[model samples]
Target: MTRPDANPAPDADAARLAALGYTSEFRRDMSLWANFSLGFTYLSPVVGIYTLFAVSLALGGPPMFWSLAVVGAGQFLVALVFGEIVSQYPLAGGVYPWARRLWGRRWAWMTGWVYLVALLVTIASVSYGAGPFLARLLGFEAGPASTTGCALAVIAVALALNLAGTKWLAWAAIIGFSAELLGALVVGGWLLIAERHHGLGVLFDAFGAGSGSGYLGAFLAAGLIGIFQYYGFEACGDVAEEVPDPTRRIPKAMRMTIYIGGAAAMFVCLALLLAVEDYGAVIGGADTDPVTTVLTEAFGPVGMKVVLGIVLISFVSCALSLQAAASRLLYSYARDGMIAGSRLLRTFLPHRHVPPYTLAVAAAVPALVVLCSLLSTDALTKIISFATLGIYLGFQMVVLAALRARLKGWRPSGAFTLGRWGLPVTIGALVYGVLAIATMAWPRTPEAPWYDDYIVALSGAVVIGLGVLYLVTARPYERGDAPAGDAVPGGPAAAGTAPSSEPSTRRRP
Candidate 1:
């Protein structure tokens, strides 16, 4: 691989990738802001909070806003640790590539497998979430047919955006980020200042008493609302090979993505919670969709429709970013002859250098998953829950892999080193990740079907089980390039062009 700490000129990112053993294929054209835009849009504060706000509020009332803060702090640790790791590796495939370099082939393959499923399910979930709003905008009944049709339409549009190539993606991301931020800022500010329904004390009122398990259960359920919001920061790292000065720029972009996206999420959620004319009505589930009800009241019918249109744009950007990230992850594995049909899947377009086959697979699978939405409401819920669990597991794998690697004498390289803070932060991230996973997978609602109760664990087992099955049965060929850990044998650095992987003695702030 390229020297972990090396920073070549703007045009040298590709040359550095070649030194790492692959040819220069991608355009490497995304600017730093474009990278951040992609991450922000993928995180999509408006989409995540807006979609889940009612459930969260119903579960924990106004105190649900506090859960966002807790999740945000925990996720910030994960993001900080990832920033350091991505700086050292700075490869495509995000968690998959990072895991491969930190652990080994089986680990990387499994990580990518989990994350790929997560991304596809994420695509489906985002599209499905958009369905109701789109239905509202179009004056449809939001039945199974309408929602499924809306999801398919979203998938088609996102596919077109992906096929247009990375430059178009960057522009879409920038536009989407601007619109989401504007929506969050403008809508949230208006809500906060326009009408005062309650005081700030509502935020501290733990309405968890309604749950039989007390405040703890309600808080845990609400925490799930924020778990999926913080992940897209890694989307920046997924396309690291295409970003100039990736080691420096990508790491910073990841951290900033979290900071900016988290702020927007909290701002909007708090705004909505405070803006609702009747907090009691929302907590009581008075309106089937409290967010829409509150927004429609706050902005009136026609005005709320316009706001929904902005939210629709945010969803489009979110889906586009998810598809792009997923395709890059597929290409990352295929680049090293790891995935099935490697030759075809890894093929980049002749001029654009985008991986068309991977993109097709990425788009097609999600469109298919949307069909599950047509099955029944239960199926759709389970499917979206599948995405939430798979993604969190993938994240924890990377955190665990980093922790294990550090114990094995791995010292990260790059200008963005964590220095003396590395071990503590990495450990904190791991602890938080494990706890978050446990909270999400705890079978919190026993009244739901056993399948729904343990949905995360069940879906997680299936995905990981399939990955293990493939690795064991096929005995697929592993390549000399893209080995599992740092200091890959015979890589460019090993050819004496740069210093060997360093001992873990130095400290940097």
Candidate 2:
């Protein structure tokens, strides 16, 4: 792809700079550790532990590990594609901003709004999830009041961190991330040593010994569950603007995260599998909290309590990072005038040199969604998954668009292009994306619940319907291009060019 001139004229320079930060100059404050850690913490084994349970119950058992590998392979391809685009266009707007550059403003607006909604939904899920863990730690049930209180608290903490600026957030992430990493290793190591008699070979062979489906299917199903555990790491890309030289640094961080996080998750999955003496009981979906169930069985109440403590920490960290990602996404859409309350959502406090108000709004919206879910307990999981799947689908669309641009001869200005690996990787990611979407709509249970089977499609339709309404009512008000903000020369969104992959817009703060 031919690159756009960073700042072709004085007027262009001013406009681009204005897009960086509304109230202050753009500052790339995130480091390698922070970027990678942010992703790592969100996808740690603790989070994976729960995901494994969900997936196991959904698509058989143990085979979830094999499917985990499949999804990882799929994510690997998409990451490669992301590496290429992000290296070329490293802006905070992430997938949508990239889209704007390749496509045009209108489509970019649509993409950003859809993505923002999806991110908000994800935040609600994560925040909601933190409640039960916190409640359990405090020796209480995950009642509505408990869940809502925890959710609100988590959002409040995230808002505070963002208000403190990128350095503070990075430091907080580093500390939390370190704790999570060590916690996983400690817990997983203990589980392994306790069950060492099972033999290393058992980890590979224990899959279908009694499941009646044979080893292949059992392992595949287990892998599927394992896959969802690692799904949230890609949120790293959304925080690109915070990192210095993001085009170069973010890709490196993302790659490192995949390696470290993938190994860590796989190791934990193995530990859990080996530790469970009875696959039938462990995988029987007793309480839908297999990790806790396994620990309670293995080490009794004391051991169970310790493990729960670690899980609580992990949940808090994951919720924080997730909330941060959601805020950035909302901020990006608001900067482009895509959201309903665009002006308020676009505010940046000069004292904090961050969008404190916008961050608050972002956090509150998701919490409200969670509060709304309290009234419909039955639909909570389905609704959250449905919305999250829509966001993931949007991610796939953006990557495909980027790939198509490359195929049509859009070469990168930077040295980080995927080179010979682009087509194969892009194709794999797209294929996986389609499969994932299909799986969501698939009838997982023999007798599927009405909402479980169709929620993703239904919720996705509603999100799109809202987008259509905005297109008709708000499109004219959205400037053909984003308003001015602080930007650097040779930045991600190059001004004054017809982008090849996304909407042609310059810089998003």
Candidate 3:
């Protein structure tokens, strides 16, 4: 529970990085608020709730609101586990570097690959989700062409801001966090106070929405709202090298992202559910877009447009944060010479404090995924399904690795740790991750094509299989000269005063 320094010295941050077997390549300019904002924006309650609200309600009725709290509690455990890991490691790539130090090079390589792919897909998913909002904000009809065009445009703008520097990224995240939180509060508060049509008792009413196995199946299916809303917290750790006193600050920011982001999401979902004028229309498939209908009825066209503008900002910010995290993970991989074109990918632009090549890949891959949506109508759905599943799988891998390390006597030596609760928290996180993954990957679309029904599981298997194939064939880990495994003798606790072995080559501005 030690407080992080308000403004830790650059030398201290550099020394910590060097102690972990790396130089200070990224500019440690992000403040505590900025770091929290990055994770908050990536979580993007506005985007997650707005996109999934109708689906969740249709699947589990008013009781679906409980899923937010359920997933939040579960993910908070995961966040606690992650906080301890990142506190000790405080590495740039988040999960990848933590896994490397906790486990080994092969484990780290696969973890990074799975996580990198998930981040890229999430970028595409967020960008694509923004298309309709952007198109509507511009007074245009949202169609395949318009949506795809807008999605690509969003990617370009986010990429431009990211390439500007960590400063611009921080600014964007702060702005996005402000706008999204304010919008959610204003809208949710308005609906609750002025537009609520249903009584509080309605939340317990199943309203005949679940299948034969009862509401449990439906509630679990609707759990994606909470599962997806809680993760962007890890993005805080993804930029650890860019934040001063990261070992102390990043852990707090991760927890803050979950607590604040979860509350905002619950507020939005609750307001939307209670404001629905016709629950039957939503649950019975008569009204496909209840969010827009309710907002339009309450706010009229002009006010609804304004809200859509806010939602669009949330989406853009989400995509931007995802891109930033993706670039950092790629940079981390290349820094260790673990991928093709390592030199160029790891090239740091001291002036901008950004990895330009990796940034391009981050933007380009998502853009390609967005474009692929043009070929098949279900492509985006499949991509989104896989994205969520892939993220959860990658997270569990890290949690599992941490547990293994702990059992082998790897005590966390950082500012923030669970102490006596480490094992229990790690176990809870792993269990939660496993159940959540099963819920997400379960085949629900029995009527659709077999591939569509099993998209989440199949896509995940394919991605992991491909990563294994490449790892075995390319043997990138063996060729890398960079330090691997636990480089620090006794963890970061011993790093603060340790003399820096790898001094930074670039001049600071």
Superposed model 3: Cα runs more than 4 Å off: 3-7, 487-509
| TM-score of every prediction relative to native | 0.92, 0.83, 0.94
TM-score of 2: 0.83
Error of 3 at 496 (Å): 26
Number of the candidate with higher TM-score, 1 or 2:
1
Q: What tens-digit string does per-residue lDDT give for candidate 1 at 1-509?
A: 22455567865665555444455467777889999999999999999998888777877878878777888898889888888888777777798878877777677788889999999899999998999999999976888888888988988898888888789888999999999999889999998898558889988886543556788788778776788677799899988877888888887888888889999999999888887766666667676588887788888888888898999999999999999999999888776667778778877778676889988888889888888667666555567567988888899899888888887777776567787788899999989888888887788778988877887788889899998999888654244244356533333331223322332111111
Error of 1 at 454 (Å): 1.4
If the candidates were sorted by their lDDT against the true structure, best first, what order would they fall in?
3, 1, 2
Candidate 1 overall Cα lDDT vs. reference?
0.80
Pick by TM-score: which candidate is best?
Answer: 3
All models: lDDT?
0.80, 0.64, 0.86
Stretches of candidate 2 exceeding 4 Å from the true structure: 1-26, 51-59, 196-224, 282-287, 297-306, 377-380, 446-449, 476-509
Write one digit per residue (lDDT tens) for candidate 3, span 60-162: 8889888889889999999999999888888888988888878777888999999999999999988988898888889999888899999999999999999
Off by over 4 Å in 1: 1-7, 207-211, 477-480, 487-509
Q: Which one wins by lDDT: 2 or 3? A: 3
Model number with the top lDDT:
3
